[model samples]
Target: MKWKTASTLALLSAVSLIGSACSGGSGSGSGDSEEVKDASAKESKDPVELVFYSMSRDSEASFNERYGDAIRKKFPNYTIKYIQRAQGSDLPDLINAGTRIDIHWDSIGSFPSSNMVYELSYDMSDLIKKHKVDLSRFEPSLIDAMKQLGNGAIYGLPVYNERMALFYNKDLFDKLNVPYPQDGMTWTELDELAKKLNVEKDGVLYTGFSPSVNHLFLTNQYSLPLLDKSAMRPTITNEKWKQVLELQLLQPTQNPVYQKAMQANKGKILDLNQFAKDQSLAMFISSPLMPLVMKEELSKFNWDLVSEPTMPDAPGVGPQSYPGYFAITKMAKDKDAAMEVIKYLTSDEYQMECAKKGIMTSLKSEEIQKALGQESAFKGKNFGAFFYNKFPAIADKTVEESQVPILATYTKNLNKLSAGEMDINTMMRTADEEASKLLDGLKKK
Candidate 1:
């Protein structure tokens, strides 16, 4: 399970919320069962009922159907069962029982890890050494991040590794006679592109959210060099952070990207998918799961994802991590079997299938070639560049770091206040003030 969590359920809820915007970071899973099995299990035995736990119902169901058909029919000795939930389900009580709970998939740095899980369940060094698994298969940064977290030990396997990219609709691009984004566009370049595409004449708006200041992911990446949290102080006065805030206040005359207020502060009802459905906006910064989200909202609009603009002088490799992984509890009865389940889900073969379906995976899935094989909305661009491994784990020690509070509780409520129902300066001040108090309270505890 991930070490950071606002709630046990936040990770689950995040999956659906960003299901289209963030790549899958949580590991896949099914249930809690009795660890004990019949002693003579190896011989002419009944299929092993493997219980799994997970938050993704659709992806897990698909994996079980495809993988189970191939393996189970051939071996006829394994059966898989899954237990799915929305984010925030309290699962410790179930695991505290003697139930096997074969495996659980969750976000790495985002899911709650305190009471539910930790870094100790996995013995990665042994498994890699014994299995002869090639660490070379993964990029160096990912391996380095793991080592940093586990005191230089491989703690767990990643299932849904992800980062943000600019996904723009091609229909609008053609209509506006604008060029698509190339690699390494600076904030200035993004502004020009948006200006070229801003085609709002008869109430129809065509603009770029490409480098929108309001987007936290884009702003964060742009400021990574100055805001490493490792060496820098958490000062709001930092110019880079102020630029992030400026992104939210779109100056249409300068940048042409359409601005849709899918209020994170007001607890606004419109989801990302809903905003796309309205078709008033053009580009959106989202995850690989964009296709899944588009299944409902996209129509007549051809869209593709591009690597997010990197910091001018920052050293991150590429593709920012969104944080998710799975683990077994020290309290489990069938710890061995539970661990086996984790191994299977994180296996490259399973991850490959997920990537082909455009389901974002954390493991370095081979299926990515399948996505890259065809002509795309990106026109032979290296989409994989957005996912390059990291240089170091994020070291933010802010209030959001201590606890993964409900993003909407604070962000949403503030949006309502900004719509002239309240005041912007007052709203921001209140948030900083309230958030500070909350952080101090958590520290005391």
Candidate 2:
């Protein structure tokens, strides 16, 4: 509700300002006129080169195919220059050399860690107002995420989004005579279904469920913060975290059959590969990109997807939004041009194209949602599952950069907890302690 109000107010303000400028009222001075003219010229069909740096390790070819080509087609007069992450031309290298980076893009999770950490972030609030870019058009959670990262300043616009879903090997379910997972199944229901599928067959153990635990923690449906910024400490020792661990890790690992399977794999946790490649995993909760990423291996097995399982107390809520963003960096020579490019990228027209190409859009348009995966290799699959559940509100980051290492520590402890080496309370306690130590060490540096 707050996001909607904020966006509405912003839109109204931009409109009012534009109307006043156009009317040339007494308040509109000569300088204001020049500024308006300059802004208009920036959006015109003028030839300009924009250098884009991607921290997400997007290759030059991939960038061109996915975005560069489209941008060039849209603005034929514009020259697109892409600099991907590499050994010698990384962010630090570019910054040290004073390279002009007009736009910097990355997943939201990594944006603050890299771009913000380097102080390369440029607040796009004024540009957003000048361009009348309607933030309400995007998924509310996505805009909220960006605002949280910028501490109320608009830093970037979400280009696309990704979310977790329940991917099931239909062949495995048929083989074991278990019903397929449904869309609105709760965690308890999913656990029961997993137990039915976690049986030994043909001398091979079939794991019922193998979720990406890291993703689960990062995008938990409860919107839990991983760290306490005020205290500069980890929040892993809380009761909510313990409940999450018990449901996601402890309960599943408590199965003796699952433990035996882990032992056979030499204590390695079963992953998505086991589901896609080995076909020994029944249900795997993962991102929708899996369909395209593992197209070949997945084609060999009959599979379908359902909405990600929900917590009983938070029914129908899905994981928090994980979207990639397009940000205009502070090093840009022409901020207006950069903002224009970003505005175009997030427009409804481009978002529609992205959806048609089987790319998930950050917009909340029903038409775009329906067109999802329409042109992809997996068109006939249940694409509706992706939108079945409501995305949970994103939690504000505390120590934004400390998340990765703390999560790593928690993940390691999770393995131990699963193997009966530590109880849930002990796991949480130790993880918090280790995370605190890690934060202290980082502060010293």
**Over 4 Å off in model 1, which ranges?**
1-49, 55-63, 66-76, 86-89, 96-98, 113-124, 147-153, 210-219, 222-239, 247-275, 315-319, 332-341, 361-431
Best by TM-score: 2
- Tens digit of lDDT per residue, candidate 2, span 1-445? 0112211112211111111101111111111245754654447487789999876555676667666776776566789999877889888898899888888877766677777887888999998887767777789999998888788987788877877788999999999999999998888888988999888878999889865777657878898877775676787877777777777767666787888888886886677667888888898777656665556778898999998888878888988767878889888887877777776677666666666655677889898788877776677888788899998887667435433587777777667778898788887878888887888888887
- The CA lDDT of each predicted structure is 0.45, 0.73
TM per model? 0.68, 0.89
Name the lDDT value of residue 215 in candidate 2: 67
Give lDDT tens digits, candidate 1, residues 241-348. 445444423222232223333332133322244235555445655655444434445544576656665444454434346545655544444544444444445545
Clashing pairs in 2: none
